[model samples]
Target: MAHIHLGEGSFPLWALVLWTLLGVGLISAVVYRVRKGGIKTHQIALAGIGAAASFAIFQLNIPVWGGIHMNLTGLVGILAGPLLGALIALVVNIFSAALGHGAVGLLGANTLVNASEAIVAYYAFKTLMGMDWDVFPASASAATLGLSAGAFLMGAIIVISGVNGSALPRGDLTVAVAGLVGLNLGVAVIEGLLTGFIVQFLASVRPDLVGLTDRDTREETTGVTA
Candidate 1:
């Protein structure tokens, strides 16, 4: 209900083809990585956990103007890393589709959009850490950036599909884009604060789950050891 649920006719053939290729490539890469990493039992369990969490949370519709839901994309990326995060997104989308949440025709497109969010969040968090920012600010900014990107992509998909069918009114694309941006920006702010606080708590209580160390903290620890 939250995601764009454009049915079979919404996307052009070229767009569908492109999205399918992209999804396949990404999935292949993740599978290769997991294979190379030796596929530990714990790793599989962790990935299952992330996928289940994403699937469950994705179903909780909030009934905003655009029917937005709590995505938790960035949080999963922070915990699972980019590859597993992307996999989780696809799994969630597929499962959601089964329950009449998102459209089966848009599966590839939806997977690309959500997977990109996870990748962005993971890399942005690492970049912020490399710049010596603390965990909370880094995570919050990453979540905001990731969600903003997802929002933009979602708007684009809606506009393109709508335009293809002349379903939108004259110049309504601007209004749609603006509305999505504004709505997502508000959601991003809330998610940012939530991610920041949750990350802080995880860092203190279960750094193993966070799997991140502040550069400054690491350097200090190194110096102490030296």
Candidate 2:
């Protein structure tokens, strides 16, 4: 939802370098964690499933104000967990760029934005679940938080890049950030509902996959102990 679809030259070289470094570091951490977890068959399958879902769903593109569209990144995170979620987001962004949904030059920044949303969504959901909350509401809140973070990151990037000018013109940057935040605040509700319902359904039926069942909880505890 907070994807930066700008073309080349959207960001200065320094900003690009910083974002690229952050993206690389995050991806590296994802790779390390995935490898440490031994890359289970279920994880691989879920990654493919989540990535496909994200790609297909992003095309829905409900035309919101300001050229922004609703996205299902939180749902992908709920399905794939953090590491696989970020990996799947990277795959989605790359494929989307190839398909002209975004620019190649913006891939690093977009990947970081999407991956942060996914990682936040995963952990937020897990934390809420640990607190004995109902799945739907918990998921909805987590999705909202995830999308909010992504939106804030997008605004920060724009501001730090001088709002595409020599300096961040205070008025223009304020208006731009206000618009971005307002649009995302509305879209976050849509995303949250979508994620909440889907996650609720999955938790009800395939609770093992979502770590919602007692058996899965016990195994998770045992793994931590081991």
Candidate 3:
């Protein structure tokens, strides 16, 4: 949802290099962590499924807010965990760029934007669950917050990088970006509700799939003991 649809050279050369390096650094760290910790077979399968779903949704641009699309990165994060979710973001963006839906050069910036949503959503979901919030509300709130974070970050990046060949002043550009971010927040709500329903359904049918089995079991045992 936070994709920058600008062309290859839309960003200044220096900004391009800087964002690319930062994106690379983030991926490198994730890779190292993955290697050190090792992912489960199920997680790898989830990652594959997430990447496919994310890529499919990425192409179906809604005709609102300058044709924004839902990333579903929040849902991905919740199901697949943050590391795999971030990787899914990268993969989806790369495939989208290949199809000319997004700028190839802006992969780094876009990946950071989407990956942040996944990472934030994953932690937020865990935090809410830790507080004993129900699945529907927790997932909905986490997804909304995650998408909102990405929207603001997208605005910040655009403002900081300064669009090439644009006549808009810095102040005006910031304001414009803010408007776009605001629109994205509106879209986030709709997507969040949908995610909530899906997560709730999954939790009901397969708690283990959503990492809820242990919590549910513990609660059941406590009730029995009491």
Candidate 4:
């Protein structure tokens, strides 16, 4: 929900290069981990489906917070796992840029923003579930937390990069970005609820698809043994 809408040349050359390099590094690490760990066949299938869904949702522009949109990156991370989820973010941004939805130059910065959401959400959800929380509450809380993280990261990138050609001073820019971040938090609650319902429905019918079966089995076994 925190996609940057700035056009090309919005950031200075140094900022662009710096962000691009960082993004490349992140992707490279993810690729190496995926190769070393070897993804399961089901996870590969899930990644494909998550990529398609994430791309589709990325296109639906909701007219809020100066034209924001839902990315569903949290759900993608939850279903596809972090490594594949990060890849899905890259793929969705690439397609979006190709279609004129986002600027091609900011792909690196944007990828980092969306990827953080997925990564945080996946870990947060797992942690909450491990603490004996119910699926709906845990998933919903994790999704909200994930979106919030993306929103803050988006604000930080904008502030640090300092948009070129903008007349506002650094202090003013930080204030403005803070306002935008607040608006995004509001949007996150709505999107988070939507994600929660979708995940809960999937868990009800296909627990294995969401990686809930193993958790459930372990809990049941512990109860019997205890």
Computed on alpha carbons, the lDDT of every model, listed in order, comes to 0.76, 0.81, 0.90, 0.90
lDDT of 1 at 72: 81
Q: Ten residues in a row with the worst lDDT in model 1? A: 1-10
Best by TM-score: 3
TM-score for all models, in order of appearance:
0.86, 0.88, 0.97, 0.96
Residue lDDT tens for model 1, 1-226: 1257555666777777777787788888887987788544554666787787777778887776646776788877877788888888888998888988877878877887888788888889889977878889999999888877887787776666553575678477768666866787788778877878887798778776666544435777778442
lDDT for 210 (candidate 1): 68
Looking at candidate 3, what is the lDDT of residue 169?
100
**lDDT-better candidate, 1 vs 2:** 2
Model 4 stretches astray by more than 4 angstroms: 224-226
**Of 2 and 3, which scores higher on TM-score?**
3
> What tens digits encode model 3's per-residue C-alpha lDDT throughout 1-226?
6788788798999999988898999889899999999998888888898889888988988776556889799899988999998889899999899999888899999999999999999999999999999999999999998988998988888999999999999999999888888889998898899889989999999888789988998898889552
Instruction: Select the stronger candidate by TM-score from 2 and 4.
Output: 4
Angstrom error at residue 214, model 1: 8.2
RMSD, every candidate, angstroms: 2.8, 4.4, 1.1, 1.5
Model 4, poorest ten-residue lDDT window?
Answer: 217-226
Model 2 TM-score is: 0.88
Expressed as tens digits, the lDDT of each residue in 29-89 for candidate 2 is 8889888876657767888888887888776665554367766888778777888889887
